[model samples]
Target: MALSDIACRNAHKSDKAKDGKAFKLFDDKGLFLLVKPTESGWGKWWRFKYRFDGKEKQLSLGTYPEVSLGQAREKRDEARKLVAAMIDPGENRKAVKEARADSFANSFEVIAREWGSKKVQTWDEKNNRSKRMLERNIFPWLGAKPIADILPKDILASLRRIEERGTIETAHRTLQICGQVFRYAVATGRVDRDITQDLKGALPPAKGEHFAAITEPKEAAELLRAIDSYQGSLPALCALKLAPLVFVRPGELRAMQWQDVNLETAEWRYLVTKTNVQHIVPLSRQALAILLELQPLTGHGRYVFPSERTPSGIRCMSENTLNAALKRLGYGKDKMTVHGFRAMARTILDEVLGVRPDFIEHQLAHAVRDPNGRAYNRTAHLPERHKMMQQWADYLDALKQGAQVIQFPRQA
Candidate 1:
C-alpha cells in the first residue's frame, strides 16, 4: 500500500515470528523504499528501486530511518538524472570501485617482470646493465608496492639504502633506472607523475677522475715495442699495431668487421660508429701492410678480430687482453695502457708532427665546431687528412729508426 512520510518514519522492526520478512512502502509519488530483515540478528535495512534507460534498476541508497525521507528523495532524484542520461548508475559505481582497487593493487614486481622481457628485446648493453641492477637492488625493496603509491620519499629511502653500502655510483645509476621506470609508468597512464623527477642534485656528486691512459710518446713507443714482442695471437698483435694508427676506442676496434675495411682503396669505413654516423678512416701504407699480413688468417671471418675460442664466428675480444699484455711488460697503474694510444697520437700529432689541431680533432672523431657555426662531419677535412695520415705514419717510422726529430710549424 502507498505510504506517507510519517508512516515510513514510524515503521518498526517485526519480531522473529515473522521469519525476517521484508515490507515495501510507496510514497504519493512512484518512489518506493524497501525494509528487508538481515540474515544476521540485526534489524531491517532499506533499498530503493528506480527506472533507468527505459529499464528498471535498483540502487541501494541506505538503511531505513538512518536515511530519512528527505535524503532518500534526494538520492532518487540524483539517480533519475543518471537514468535520463542513459547511464546505469549501479554499473558505473561498480566500475569506478574496481578501477580504484586495481590502481592500488598493481605491484612493482609485476612491472619489473614486464620491463625485463621488453628490455632484453629492445635495450642495448648499457640499458641491460641498468635492468640487472634494478633486479638485484631496487626490485627487492619496492617491487611489491603499487607504482602509483611509491612516493619521492620511498625512492629516496631506497637510494639511501644503496648509498649505505658506499657504492655512490651504483646509487646514482639505480636512481636513473628508477626514474626511467616511473616515466614508463607515466607514458602507459599507470601513474600520474614521476616522483624521481625532483631527485636531481639529491645524490652525492661523482668524484672527478681522468681516464686511465699513457700520455707520453716515449712510454707509448715502449708499449708498442713490447706488444710487437708479446707472444699472443695474431689478432691481438694486429690490434696492437692498428691501435696507435687508428686511435679508435678499444671497443670499436674489437668490434670491427672485415666488411668495414677496404685494403685496395686504403679506406676503413665505420658504418656503425660510436657517434651514430658513418666515418671513413684513410689507411696509411703501413696500416695496409699490417692488414695484408693479417688477411691470410682473419680474411675469411666476418670480424677483423674474431675470438680465438669461437670457430667460424666473431666474438668480441676480452677488454683486458691489451692491458694484460702491457702488465706483462712491467708497466704498472701509472704507466702506458691500451687506451693511452689515443692520447699519445693526439698529443704527438699536434705537438710534434705540427698537424692542424682541427684536422687532428676531426680525425679523432671528436666533435668540432665549424667556422659557420655548423657541426663538423667525419669526412670534413679528408683531403688534408689523407696526406696527414701518411706523414704521421712516416714520422712514427722515423722515430722508430732513432732519427733526430725537428718540430714542424703549428697551424695558425
Candidate 2:
C-alpha cells in the first residue's frame, strides 16, 4: 500500500532500545519513509530501492517533512525511468560530482600556474619577475574568474588600470602575458577562444624614443672610458666593461655563466631567454681578455658575474647592478641606460666600422628575415659576424686611444 502524507508527518519515535531498531513504512514503487529514532524525536527519510543491470541500488530522495510524500514518489518515478533505460541513478550522481571536480581544476589560477611551471623552465630572472607580474596585474582581477568566461572587455579593463599607473610598457607586457595564458588555456581545451585578439588597437601607442644610446663614436669612446674607471666590485666592473663589447641584453649579460664561455675557443654560447633560442656570442679579443682576467675570481662559481652581496656567490648579479654602477659614474637615466649598450654597438658598427647590417643584426640576436622572408638562423652569418665583431672591438680600442676615426658615408 502507498503511504499517505498524514502518516509520514504523524510518524513518532518508538523506544526500541532493547531491540536496537527503528520502524519503516512502505509505499508503492519501492518508495518508503524510514522512521529512524533520534535523540529528540523520530526522523523520517525518503528512499527508493530498485534494480538496474541485474544489480540492486538505492537512491536517497531526501528527508521526509523536507521532501514530502508526493515529491518523493515523483523522484522515484523519474529514477525508475532511468532504471528502465539500463542506467543507474547512483552513477549519474557520481558523474555530476566528477564534472564539477574537473571544472574546478580548470579554474584560471590553477591553469595559469600549470602554464607558468612550463614557461619558467627557460626563464632567467628566476621566474620571480613573471610570477609577480601575474600576481600583481592579472591575478586579482581574473584569477578566480573562469578562464572561459573572461571576455575581451575584462582583459582590456585590467590592462587599462595598469596603463593608468604610467607604466605603459608594463601594461603592454602584462597584456601579452595574459594572451599567452589564454592561448595556453585554449590549447588545453579550457577556453574556446583567445579573446585577446579582439583587443587589437585597444592600447595607447608606446613612446617611440629608443633607449638612450651614445651612438656617436666620440661619445661612446667617452662612455667606455668612464666604465673602465668605475671603482666598483670586480664583478660589477667586469660586467660594465663587457656590456658594450658583447652588446647583449642587460639581463643576458648579468646572468652569464662561466660554463657558457669558452675563452680558449673565443666563443660564448648560451640560450637567449627572451627569444627562447640558443645564441653564440663570438668573443672579441678585447672581450676575451677581460673574461680571462676575471675568470680566476668567478670561475669557481656558476655565474661569471655572481652576486657580491652573497657569500655563497651562487646567484647571478641583480638586473640593476650595471645601471646602479652607471649612476655612480654620474650617468643619469636620460644620459645612458644599461640596455643602451646594444644601441651604441649597433650604431657604431654600421656608421663607423662599415659592417653589414645583416651581420650586425644577427650578432645582436635581433629577429631578422632573410631575402626569402625566413628567420635568419641563430648561427647564420657566423663568418661575417665573426669578422664584424673583431673589427668593432678594434675600432673601439682605437677610439679609446684618442685615434680620430672617420665616419663612413651612408650608401643610398
Candidate 3:
C-alpha cells in the first residue's frame, strides 16, 4: 500500500531494531524517505534515494525528525535537477573541495619542478646559474612549505642564514632566485602576489669586488713570454697567445669551434656572445699563424680546443686550466690571470699605443659608440682593427725582445 503523511507520522519506532528492511513513507506522489534501523544504538537513519538520468543516487538528508520528510523531498528535487543536467551533484561537490585543497597544498618544490619542465626554456647560462643556486640553498630550506604561507620574515630568516656564512654575494643571488621563483608562482596562479617584493633593499648589500687581474704592461709581457714557452699542446699554446690578441672572455675562447673561424678570411665569428650579439674578431697575422699550426691537430674536431684524450671532443676547457698555467710561471691571481690580459691590452692600447679608447673598447668586445652617437656592432671597424691587431701583436713581440719602443698613432 502507498504511504501518506499521516501514516508516516504514525509509524513509530519499535523497541527492537530491524535489519535490512526499511520503513518507507511518501510525502508526495513519487517522492519518499526510507528510514532504516541500525544495530549501533541509534534511533534510525533516513536516506532519500531516487532515480535520475537512468541512474540511482542517494542524498542522506539526516535522521527522521532532524530532517523532516518535507525537507528530504526538497533536497531530493534539487539533486534531481543536477542529475537532469547530466551532473553528479555528489561527485561535483567532492571535486570542488579537492581543487581547493590542491591549491592550498602547492609548495615551492612542486612549483619549481613544473617551472623547470615547462618554464625554463628561454633561460640563458646566467639564469641557469641563478636557478642552480636557488635549488642548492633556498629550496632545501623552504621548498616543502606552501608558497602562500611563506612570509617576508621567513624569507629574511633564510637570507640571514646564508649571510651568517659570510657569502654576501650568495645571499643576494639567493634572494634574486627566490624572487624569480615567487614570480613564477604568481605567473602560474599559485600565489596571489610576490612577497619577495618587500624584500628588496632588506638584505645587506654585497661588497664591490672587482675580478682579480694583473693590469701592468711589463708583467703582462713576462706572462706572454712564458705562454710562448709553455710545454702544453699546440691548441693550448695558441689559445694562450690569441687570448691577449683577441681579449675575449676565457669561456668564449674555450668554446670556440672550427666552424666559427675563417682562416682564409682572417676572421672569427661568434654567433652567441656574452653581450647576446654576434661578434666578429678580425684575426692578426700572428693569430692566423697560431691557427695554422693548431689546424693539423684539432682541425677535424668540433671544438677548436678539443681535449687530447677524448674522441667525442671537449665540452669546455677547465676553468682552472689557464690559472694553473699562470701558476706554473710563478704568477698568482693578482700577478697575471687569464682575464688580466684584457685589462693589460685595454690599458696599453689606450695609453701607450695611442689607440682611441672607443676603438680599443670595441676591439675588447666591450660596449662602444658609433658616429651617430648610438651603440653599434663595433666589428664594423674590421679592416682598421686587423691592422691594429697586427701592430699590437708586433709591439708586444718587440717589448718581449727588449727592443726600442715604436711610436704609436696619436689618439683621435
Candidate 4:
C-alpha cells in the first residue's frame, strides 16, 4: 500500500520488534520508509530501490518529517523517470558528489594553503604574511576556482590590482609565490600544467634597486656615532648597535632566539628562514659584548630582542623597531635602513677591508657554492670567517674613531 500523510507522520517501529531493531514500510515500486528504533522513539529515512543493468540499487531521498510523504513521492517519480531512461540514479548522484568534492579539493586556495603549510618551517613570512597575501590579494579573486579553470588572464588581473596600488615589487613577489603554488598543484596531479607559465612577462618587470646604506668610511663613522647617542628601549638599542656587527638580515636579527646563541663558542647558530639552511655567525668580541650587555636584560626571554610594547614578551622585536630607531638617529630611509646593514658590511669588507669575497658572502649567509655546483656546507670557512669577523669588528672601531681607511679594488 502507498504511504499516506497520516501514516507517515505517525510512523513508529514494530511494537514486537526488539530494542535497536529496524523495520521498513513499503509504499510501492521500490519506495519505502526504513524506520529504526531510537532512544527517544524512532529514526527514519526515505529510500528508493530499483534495478539497473539487471542489478539492484538503492538511493536515499532524505529523512522523515523533513522529507514528507508527498515530497518523497515526487522525488521517487523523478528518479523513476531517470531509471526508465536506463540511467542509474544512484550512480548519477555518486558521480555528482564526487565531482563537487574534486572541485573543492582542487581549488586554488585549498591547494595554496597546503603548499604554504609545507613551507612553514622555511618561510620568511614569520608573521604569516604569506597567508595574508593570499587572503588579501589572490584568494579574493581565484581562491574558489579550480586550478584548471584559472586562466592566465585571471592571474594577470589579480596582479594588476596589486600593481595599481603602487606596490609593483610586492605584485611581482606575489606572482612568484603564486607560481610556486600553481606548480605544486600541477605536481600533485590537480592540474596537468602550471598556468602561471604562460604569464611570463605579463606583469611589469621589477625595478633593479638596492637598499640605502652608508658605505663610505666618513659617512659610516657619522652614522655609528649617531647611533651611539640615539636612546631607545634596551632591545632596540642593542639591535641597532649589533646590526652592523653581525650584519645578518633584519628578520634574522630580530628573530634571534636565546637558545641559538652560544656565548662560550662565540657563535650564533640558527636556520636561515629564507634559504632553509643552517647558518653559523661567528660573533666578534664587539658583537659578543653587545649580546653580553643585553643578556642580563633579555637572556631569560624566548627572543633576545623581545618587543617591549607587547604584553606577552614572547615575540621578537617589531619589524620596524630598528628602522624607527635609525630614523630617530637622523638616518632616513633613503639615507640608511636596518637591512642596509648587510650591504654596508658586504661592501666595506670586500672593498675597504680587502676581505675575501667568498668569506664576506658566506658571512652574509648568501649562497656560496663549490665548483661542482653543490652549495658549500654552512660550516665552510669557519676558521677563516672567525678571523675575518674579529678583524672586521676592529676595522669598524677604527672607522668610528674617524681613522682613514684605504679603499682597495674589488676582486674579479
* Best candidate, lDDT: 4
User: How much does each candidate deviate from the true structure in C-alpha RMSD?
Assistant: 13.4, 8.5, 12.7, 5.3
Candidate 4 Cα errors over 4 Å, as ranges = 1-101, 122-126, 307-310, 369-374, 404-412
Task: Give the poorly placed runs of model 1, Cα more than 4 Å off.
Answer: 1-196, 271-274, 312-314
> Which candidate order results from sorting by TM-score in descending order?
4, 2, 3, 1
The C-alpha TM-scores of every prediction are 0.61, 0.72, 0.64, 0.74
Structure candidate 1, residue pairs in collision: 109-143
Question: For all candidates, what are the clash counts?
Answer: 1, 0, 0, 0
- Which candidate achieves the best TM-score against the true structure? 4
Looking at model 4, which ten-residue stretch has the lowest summed lDDT? 120-129
Error of 2 at 339 (Å): 1.2
C-alpha lDDT of residue 92 in model 4: 85
Candidate 2, position 358, lDDT: 79
Please report the TM-score between candidate 3 and the true structure: 0.64
How well is each residue in 1-412 modelled by candidate 3, as lDDT tens digits?
A: 5445555554544322245455665555345656555576334344556665687776565666676667766776777787778887678768988976675469887776666656553233322455667677777878778888889988888899888999889888778767777888999788899888898898888885455665556666677788888887676778888888888877778778899899899989885445667888888888888888888878887778765456567454555667777777677776677777788888788777988777777777777876788886746777778888887888888877766655577666
lDDT of 1 at 342: 78
**Order of candidate numbers by lDDT, starting with the best:** 4, 2, 1, 3
Clashing pairs in 3: none
Which of 1 and 3 is ahead in lDDT?
1
How well is each residue in 99-178 modelled by candidate 1, as lDDT tens digits?
A: 86786456666665566556433233332456668877877888878998888888888888888998888888789778
RMSD of 1: 13.4
Predicted candidate 4 versus true structure: per-residue lDDT over 1-412, tens digit per residue: 7878777766673453455678888898889998887788788899999989998888999999999988899999999999999888988899999999989898999999899988655243445567777889999889999988999999999999999998888887888888889888878888888778888888788895568888887898889888888878877888998999999989889889989999999999999978888999999999999999999888888889987776466777778888988988888899999889888888889878788899999998899988899888999999999998998888888888988888766544
Residue 282 C-alpha lDDT in model 1 = 83
